[model samples]
Target: MSVYQVLERWGIKNYRVIDKKAIEEITLGASILATGGGGDPEIGLLWTLGTLARGKDVVLIHPEDIPDEVVGASVGCLGAPIVLTEKPPSQNVLEKAFKQLSSYLNKDLEVVIPFECGGVNSTVAYAIAGELGIPVVDVDGMNRAFPELHQTSWVANGSHASPAVSVDDRGNMTIIDTKEDNIRAETIARSAAMAYGGISWKASYPLTGKEIKEKSILYSQSIAWEIGKAVKKARESHRDPIEEVMKKLKETREVDSFRVFNGKIVDIDRDFGGEATKGFSSGRIRMEGIGKYKNQIAEIDFQNEWLRLKVDGETLCLPPDLIAILDNETGEPIRTDIMKYGYRGSILLIPAQERMRTKRGLEIFGPSYFGYEEEYVPVEKIVSKKGCQK
Candidate 1:
C-alpha cells in the first residue's frame, strides 16, 4: 500500500506525512503558539527541510496511539537563541544526544516527545523521530511555548527533564542525572550550553506512554497543526486570518483565546548587553494601538517568551499562559528578534493549559516566577470584565 493508503488505514486524518509544505505549515503554526519565543522558526524549519530533502518520512503520530509501555524522549535544543544562531549546530548532535540518553537509561525510546510546542521543539521532535526511523508523538509538555525547561507540564505534573544528555557540535557530551529535580536539571543543562559555546542539543524527559498520558498536555501537536492549517486556509482564501485563529482555538483547543490589541510596535527595549553575558534575551516592547484603540498604549515584558501583557496600564495576560504577536494579515508570528519598530500586528492571548494551571505549575512558572508581584488572573476573567466573550 502507498503512504496515503497507510495513513488512511491508520486513521491518520489528523496526521500529516511531514514534507516540505507540512513543515512550513507546522513551523508557522508552532511559532505563533510559541508565544513570541521558541527562537526563529527558520532555524527549526531548515533542519527539518534538510532532513526531508534526504528522502526521510517524518510521520507525526497521534498521542492516543502511544502504547502503555512504549517510552519516549523529549528532544530539544536548550540555550539562548542568539547564541544558537551564532554557533549553529551539527547535524550529528541530536543522534549523539539520543544515543547517550538511551545508553544511560538502559532502554531505547519508542518515540520522541516535544518538550514544548515551540517552532524548534515541535520540529525537533519530528526531526529526531525521522532520523531515528520512529514516529513522533503528538503529545507535548507545553501547549504553548515557554522559556525554561521546567515550565512544561512534565514538570508541572511532577515529572522531570533529567537523566538527560546534552551534546555539542564537536561530539562532546554531558550526562545529567538530577534524580528527578527538573529545575536543577534545567540549570545544569543551561550552564552546559553556555560552556559549549551557547547551544546544546538534548534528549531528556524519558517517559513511558502511561506517564506521558498522565502528565503531558495531550494532543498539543494536533492543536498547533489545526490552528496553523486554519490560518493557512484563511490566508489562501483571503479571509480574516485572525478570525480563523479564534475559530481554531475554540474548536480544537476548546479554549477561549482573545485578540487583545492591534497596533504598531513603537519601541523595543532589548537587553543588548546580553549577547554573551545573558543566556536568554530579556526585554520589553511598546506598541501604539490602532483603529478603535487609537491613542492607547500597550506593553509586554519577556524573557524569551512573552511573560506579561498590559494595555493602557491594565494587565490582560501573564506567564504560564500565552501571548503571540501575529501579522494582522498573514497570521505569521512576529518574534522578538524579528519584531521591528513600525511593524503592525495583533496580540493574541491563550489561557494556560489545564495541566499547566496546577498549583505547582503556578509556583514554578506563574507571573510571580517572572518577577510580577501580582497573582495571575485568568484571561477569560480579565476579558469578561471588559465585557468580551467567554
Candidate 2:
C-alpha cells in the first residue's frame, strides 16, 4: 500500500511531508542532540536524499495520530560512531534488516521510528519509511543519543528491543532475541558490530502504536526540527546560534538549558584500540575557556556520546543529561568521531527528558551505570546551585 493510503487507512490526517530541506534541518538539530555521538550525518543524509530522489515521499506522523494496534519498528545504524565515519553502510543493509525482521515476525511493519536522536539515526528512519511506503513517527527511543541499546526510554518504560536483526554491509546478519532482557540484546548486538568490522545496521523494537505513544519520547523529531530551524534562521540573520538554540529549547521543550562553556579544544586522550573499546570510541577532552570565561578549564569524557562534563573540578553535567559541543558560528555539533585539537565550540547542556530520568532509567544509563560514583543530578539543579558558568 502507498504511504498516503496507509495514512488514510489509519485516519492520520495531521502529518508532515519530509523533503530535502526538512531532512537537512532535522539532521542538524539531531546531531546537536546526539551529544558528541550519532555518527556522521553525511552518510545518513546521502542515503535519505537518494531515497527522496527516487520519487518516494517520506511522511512523518505524530505519536498520537496512529491507531492503537498499528505496528512500528526502528531502523538505524548501530556501532561505534568513529568506526561508522570510516565505514558507511551499503545500500541494502537497513533494507535487509527490515525485511528479515518482518519475515521473522510474519507481519508487515506499518511505521518506522528512530531509536535515537542523532545525525544518521534521525534521517535513516525516513529513508526506511520511504523505501517501505510507510510513514515515520515523530518520536524516538532516546530524545538524545546514548551508546548502548538498552539505554532508551523504551526500555526504561518496560518495552523491549529484543528479536532485533543486525545486518552488516556485506549481507551478514545476526538475529538477537533476548525476550525481556534488553541488556542481553545489547550485548549480542554489540558483539555483532565488532564481528562486522565495527559497524552494523539494526531493525528492532517492534512496538504497537499504543506502546510508542506511551513509552517513547513523544514529539522528539518535532523538537529536533524546530531546533534545526532556529539555528538556520539565526545563521541566516547573523545572530548568535548558541543563543538561538537555548531559546528554541525553552520555546519547544520548556526546559532550562545552559551554555555551560565557550572554549577551544586543547588536549585529547583517546582510549582507542583493544577489545575493551572495540565497539566504542572512548576519550577525554580538555578545553581552555575563551572570551569572558578565559582561563577557566572544562573537561568532558565520552564513550560514543558525551557522558560527563566537569569545569575546573566541579561536575556540571552527567550521564543522561545532554552535553552538546557545537561550533560557535554555525551551531553544528562537534561529534566525538570527528573532533580534533584547535576546534572551538560552545558547550550546551539540557536536562534529560522526564522519561529518561525514571527509576529504571537511572539504574540503566545513569552515572553509576557508567562506573561513576557520583549520583545523577539534573542539569537545572546544578545550574540553580552554581548559577551557570560565566
Candidate 3:
C-alpha cells in the first residue's frame, strides 16, 4: 500500500512537508537531539534540499503499515563528520549508494528508513526515496540519536546490519556481507571510509517491512517534530528552550542533564588525529564548569559518540545512553567537527531506553566493549545511586 493511504488511516493527513525553511529548523533540532554524533547537518541538508528542488515528493510511512515481505533499508553518508565538513557530498551519493546496494542484493528496494532522526541521516533517507521512487518510513532506528551504527532498534531486535554497501563520491563501492555481526560490519565500513578519504556514502541494514515494524522505533518522526515545535515556541517566547525540550521529551525524568560545565572548551584531545581510520572518532574534551558550576571541571571521552562523562573527577554519565553539548547562548548543538577551545556549552544526559538494555544490546555497546572497567548500569540506577538527582 502507498504511504499516503497508511498515514490517512492513522488520521495524520499532513506529514510535515520539509520545505527549505522547515528543513533548516528540523535539522537544527535534530542536531541538538543528536547527542553529540550523527554527522554534518549541512552536508545532509544540501543534498536533501537539492533533491526537493527536482519536484519529487519525499513521503513518510508509518512502521506498522509496511508489509512484511517488502524489503527495506537505510541510506546515509558514513564517515568522519570532520571529513564531511571539509569535503561536501556530491548530489548523487545517495542515489549511487542505493543503486549499487540494490544491484548487489539483486532486489528492488521497497522502502528507505532513516537511520536516525538527525538532520543528515533523517532527510537523506527521503532524498534517496525520491530518487528511487520509493517511500521513506516514518519510523527510525533511534528516536533520539546514537553514535554507533549497530545501536539501532533493528539490531537490538536481532536484524543484522551486515551486507552494508558503501560508496564514495568518486563512484567507488564496497559491499560488506558479514554474518550478523554489526561490529564487524562497522570495522569494514570504517576502513572503506578511511581509504576513501575519511568519508563514504553508505546504504545499510536491508530488512523486510515486517522486520522494520517489529524492531524499529515507530512514529519517531512525529516525536521529533513535536520536540522541534516545542523548542521553536520556547525560543520565540524568550524562555529556556532547552528546558522546554527536556520537558517535552520527558528527558529530565529519564536522565539527569547536569549543568555540569558552562565554561569554554579549554582543550580538545583527538585520538584518531582526524584520520577517519577506525570508523570511530576517538577524542577527549576538557571544559571548565562555569556559572553555577564555576570552579568545577568536566571532561568527556568519545569513540564516535561521547562514551564517558566525568565532572570534577566523578563519573557522571556512560555509554548505551546519550550526552549532548549545546551552545549555551543559542541552545544549538555543537558538532564534533566544530567543537573547539572556548566553545561554551551545557552537558545534557538522557537515559538509554530499556530496549537498548537488552542482553544483546549490552553485549554490543556495553561498557566492556569500550574498555571501561565497570559493568553496564542503567542511567536511572546510576543517577539515583550517586544522588546526582533526587
If scored against the real structure, what TM-score would every candidate get? 0.93, 0.98, 0.90
Over 1-390, each residue of candidate 3 has an lDDT whose tens digit, in order, gives 544554455455545455676666666766776777777777677777777898766676567766678887898777666667778778887788887778888987778888886657876887777667667777788765665677788898899887788888798889999977788888888788888988788889999878887888777666666666777787788887667667766742343444445667898998542554365567899999777778888898876567788888878777777777876556778767678889888887767656667787777777777888877776656666665532
Which residue runs does candidate 3 get wrong by more than 4 Å?
1-16, 144-147, 251-261, 272-279, 385-390
Candidate 2 lDDT by residue in tens digits, 4-74: 99988877789999999999999989988999888898888888999999999999998989888888899
Candidate 3: C-alpha lDDT: 0.73
Residue-by-residue lDDT tens digits, candidate 1, 1-390 = 333444455455666578887778877788889998777677778888888888777887777766678788988888776666566677888888987899889896767888887868788778777777777877888887876777888888878878999989887799999897877888888888778877788999999988888999888887888888899999999998988988988998788888878899999998632545447777899999899779999999988778899998998888788898889899988887567899999888888888888998899899888789998888888887886533
Q: Give the higher-TM-score candidate: 1 or 2.
A: 2
- Provide backbone clash counts, one per model: 0, 0, 0
What is the C-alpha local distance difference test score of each model?
A: 0.82, 0.90, 0.73
Candidate ordering by lDDT (highest first)? 2, 1, 3
- Candidate 3: clashing pairs of residues: none
Q: Which candidate is the best by TM-score?
A: 2
